[model samples]
Target: MRNEVIFHSEALEKEGNTLVQMGFRCDACGKTSYPVYELCPFCSSGEGSKTPLSNTGTLFSYSVTRVPVGPFKPPIIAGYIDLPEGTRVFGQIRADVKAVKTGMSLKVETGTIWTEKDGTEVIGYYYTPCGKEKGGAE
Candidate 1:
């Protein structure tokens, strides 16, 4: 899914169909927002630029869904991650539900989250516990 069409192109940066990162920074208030906004939500300023979001962040909160939803498998982990730029992004966490914890370090990456009705893979951002945090050498 290296060059697949991203689910949300505006917020997810891409280079020739390859997803780069997510979010944009407000040129006025310097606040960052996900899902790209035409106007800054914090300052209501129209000046903003698309930028690659930080790959690493601290897990703020999370939940595990044991029941399947839509095309998602059971035991789906999703949560909010606080980035270094102060942007809080919500996305699926790719890890064991029992290992997920608040304040754990997470790294963002693009992957095939699901498929469309026509079978087109939808590439999107997902977070995983950092190697070090997962008891592995980084």
Candidate 2:
């Protein structure tokens, strides 16, 4: 599952250097959600569509985990962000990892989610932090 993730290559190349916005558009109520969504929770509308999310958002909540989970790395800074579009998302802090905190500004980056298909890795879009240098993590 870890190997199947896909990233917005352009954004990955610009992390920490600039702030980029990601967006998602709701087809049901015509509401826009940050990050991304497949279905509109409002009105239970399947008409929801995805759009790039806001680049800047306020850190709403956070935690620093010292242990690793699955294929994920340890000493990780994780948090929930309140995007400009009023949606919240959990993300990995990609900075020095110590400078992250609730209320801090964060840029959103897109990446691929990895999956095993026929014993081969496949990638798909996944959200990640963009406040650190490009290729900050392996």
What is candidate 1's lDDT per residue for 3-121, written digit by digit as tens?
45677666676679566775768887999988688888889898888888888999999999999999999899999999999999898999978888899999988888998787788
- Please state the error at residue 8 of candidate 2 in Å: 10
- Give Cα distance to truth, residue 82, candidate 1, Å: 0.4
Which regions of candidate 2 are displaced past 4 Å? 1-23, 34-38, 110-138
lDDT of 1 at 72: 96
Give stretches of model 1 more than 4 Å off.
Answer: 1-3, 16-18
Error of 2 at 103 (Å): 0.7
In model 1, which range of ten residues has the least summed lDDT?
1-10
**What CA root-mean-square deviation does each model show from the true structure?**
2.5, 7.7
| Error in Å for residue 116 of model 2 | 11
Best by lDDT: 1
